[model samples]
Structure formats: C-alpha cells, structure tokens
Target: MNEAEAAVLIALLHARPRKMSWSAIASEVALRGSATALWDECFPPTLEGVNDLDGHLARAWESLEAWRSEDFRLLTVLDRKYPSRLREIHQVPPILFVRGQLRDDEVAVSVVGSRRASDRGRAVAARIAEGLVDRGIAVLSGLAEGIDAAAHTATLKAGGRPIGVIGTGINRSYPASNRALQAEVAKCGAVVSQFWPGAPPQKHSFPMRNATMSGLGRASVVVEAGEHSGARIQARLAVEHGRPVILTDMVVGATTWARDLLARPGVYLANSTAELMDLVDQLTRTAAGIDDWSNVLPDLVDH
Candidate 1:
C-alpha cells in the first residue's frame, strides 16, 4: 500500500464501527486503484471478485503506517518481523504500533493485576517488577492504576525498560493521572497502543489492551487478580498464546478458576522474584534458536 492508501486504511479502520473485512478494504482501495492492484497489494491469490480480496493486508499496512513516523514501528502479522508470541493468539490485534528499539538478548514479563489493588498488592508488584528489571527483564503493563502503575514505576526506578501498552492512543494517556509516568516510559522504553493518535479510551478497550500485554512477552506474571478480573483474561490469553503464566498468591481468596490455573500444564505458581525470573529464563532458553527473539529480547532488556 502507498503512503496515502495506508493512511486512508488506518483512518477507515479507526473510524469504522463494525470491523471491516479484507474484501471491503479492497473495495475501498479499488475506488482509487484497480481491483487487480488492490488484490496484489493486499492479497496474493488470483481474485475473481471481491470475495478473493485480503482485508488483513490492508489492516496490516495501515497499522504499520500508524507508527512509521515514530523512531520505533508498528508491525502487522503480515510482516515477517512481527513477534511470534503475539501471533499465537487467535484474536490478536491486526497490527501493533511499537516504539523504541526492539533488540536481542533481553527478557520480557507481563506484570498485571487489579486496577484497585491494595497497598500490599501494589508493593509486591513494585518489588517484583524492580527485581525483574534488575535481572534484565522488560516490565510490561497495561498502564493502568494500582498494580500497573506500580510495575511501570518500579521498572523506571530500577533503571530498566518498562513498556506501557495502553487502551488509548500513544498521544493520549488514559486516567489523566499517569501522564508523567507515560512520559517516563516513553523516554526510557516505549509507550505503545494499537489505537491511532487521539483515540479516546472506551469501556471495551481495556480488555483488548490486555491481549497486547500478553502478546509482547514470553511469560506473564499475575501479581493480583480478583474473580472476574481483566488480569485473568490476560492470563488466559497468555496460555492460549503458548507463553508461560506465573500466578502469584498476592490476591486474597483465589477463585476456583485461578486455583485450577496452577494445576494446568505449563502454568507455574510464583511467590517471589526468583520463581518469576526462573520462568522467564526457561522461556528465553527454549526460544534461544528462534529468530523472533531478535525483537523479543531487546524489548525485555534494560534500555
């Protein structure tokens, strides 16, 4: 897709109420270009009609362009460089607008918990994140209040990389309180969002944002989560994406579901930084020969 077309596709994806299919995107592109051209730009198969168009390609192109102006980038599943861990999710975001340098040899751990976390819970999150950073792990969070804030702040204080993936635009920080934290994360690590510039946070956006948190990391650590928590959703997504999930006993009164998570294969129960880092180390070691580590490692390191 050309620059203008890519911009238009991004705008349309951002503007549409219902999700647009690839054939629909191709039709839109066909307004300015030939069907054959649109198909070739977005789809590979020979197109007999609109049904043969690839909508995913258009979404991917627009997403890549969203962060192209930044020093880092936005990568789509179509791009060979997109992170493999994230691609394992069924409903993965069509594109991820990333910033900062994605390097090799670092580690990533998603630290998530209740937004209304208790003081003790917040402290645990902070200390764990700090320790993880000390060991060269990138702290990934939703940029929410409570535990999310604690994790990001702790990573920053430890002189480590902390990536904040938001439910809104990178240009717009939600909650209006973490503006300073957002700036710090942007300066030191990366402030990322799938939403376009100026997009406002909606009630549904947070759930969507959790997927990115899980996708960006090799392992996810849940510091605290109540029944019906978004953190649970993130944990499930992490498992579905084939990433290790480390559940902490930080939350009071575990849900039957949460209890079963520990019994599930590949899920570990972590009570300290040692357990968390061990999980991360194992994942990194297992993925040693993989090329996607080139992007995953740097994101996990101390920037």
Candidate 2:
C-alpha cells in the first residue's frame, strides 16, 4: 500500500492491536479507493450513517490538536519518521506519541535494571549508558527511579542522546519526580509512549512498556535486577523480539532466572563496559548482515 493509505489503516488498527493483525486488515484498506471509503467500510453501519464513531473521531481530533499545540508528533507505523526498530516487533503499536525530535538514523540501545538499584548497579548502568552513547547510540530506558534515571543522566552528561520510553501518557510524567528529567530528555532526545494523551500509570502498563522499550533498541543491556525484577522482563522481551540481551555479572552469576538467560543463544554475559560494548559490536555486525533495520517493513514484524 502507499504510505498514506497504510498510515490510515495503521491508525485504525491501534484500537485493536491484538484483535486486528496488519495483514488481516491491510487487504481491506489496500484495495479501497480512499481513506474515506475504507473508514466507511470499517465503521459499523447505522440508520442515519452518522454512527457512534463520530464521537471517537471527534475525540481523536482533539487529541491531535493537543499534540500539535505541544509540538509533540504522533507517528503512525508507515510514517517515514516512525522509529524503524519499533515497527518490526510483535504487537507493535500502530501509533507512537513522541516528544522531541528523532535523530537521523537513530540507533537505540535499551539499558534496564532494578529501580531500587544498588550502588554498583547505578554506577554500571551509567557507565554502560555513557559507553553506548559515546558510540553514537541513543540510550533507551523506562525513566524509572534508579538505574533508568542514572543511565539517562549519564547519557546527557556525555553529550549523548537518551530516549525515555515512559509507561504513562505523553502529557503526564510517571513518578512525578522525573518531570524535569522527562522534559530534559525531550529537549536532548525523545520521550516516547504508545499510550493516549492522558493515560495514567496503571500497574499493568509497565510490562507492556518493557516490550516497547525492547523494540526501540537494537539490543538490550540488563545491568542489574533481582530475580523477580521488571528488568528481567525486558530482557526476556528483547530475546523474544530477536534482539540480543546482555546480562551483567551480578545478574548472570547470582540469579537463577538470568542463568537460564545466559544459556540462550543470543544472550551474553558482560561484567564490564568493555565486555558489553564488545558484545554489542558483535551483535550489530551480525544483525547488519541479515537485515537493513532502517528499511523495516510490516511483514518483517511477525517473521
């Protein structure tokens, strides 16, 4: 389909991410003459032809207007400016609400760990963020309290970009404490979310946030996590998304969950920034041989 046609279908699919797969809905939109025709076919028919969807459409326009006023861009899957890495993943969001500008050919590396980070964990997380950003990578994180915050701060300190994939809506900052940091990331890099304009931080939102964070990156680095930490969830999601997951020494040697991860084919253990960078290089080189991530397509997601 043409880009505009595809984006309209993508925007429609956002309402039913799991219920409507791209290939299933694409056939209908692709053959339709225009977006208006496609919408007519999709929206349930009503006696007056007005339908209840007009309400939804009105609210959406309001949201778009709010986004415009704030200069936050809403990226559809087929939009040229959409993050390519995020497009090629299972359950990929059809819409991304983004604050700040996306750098040309941006490459993100997710750095995750426990929010209640140990001293060493915080230090290592910052070191990894600094190392990755120095190499021209955007350090992607959840913008949580401890390790995520440290990594973002270090990336900024190193004069590098940092993308915060937050769980809350683009309009509201989670933890409330990271409000300034959230604004800073938008200035220096981006603060992104798949949630709606005013969605609050629900407990269940973060597991999905982890997957979104994983999809934004070429690879993921788990600097520290207790056995049941959310960082481990992100690492697993990274592996499932076909991205390499780098586990720190503390996690690899101590956590049973991480031991299983280390045994996986694409997972690696790194004790220092040097080792982490080496693994990142190896994984990137391997990925480069297989796919052009910049030209990612919808079919590439489910494959």
- By lDDT, the best candidate is 2
Clashes of each: 3, 0
* lDDT to native, each model: 0.69, 0.75
lDDT of 1 at 217: 81
Candidate 1 lDDT, 197-265, residue by residue in tens: 668999778878887788778777888888888899888877677676778766424666677776555
Error at 230, model 1, angstroms: 1.0
Model 1 TM-score relative to the real fold: 0.74
Instruction: Give each prediction's root-mean-square deviation over alpha carbons.
Output: 7.8, 6.1
What is the Cα-based lDDT of residue 106 in candidate 2?
A: 68
Each candidate's TM vs. the true structure? 0.74, 0.83
Question: What clash count does candidate 1 reach?
Answer: 3
Model 2 weakest 10-residue run by lDDT: 294-303
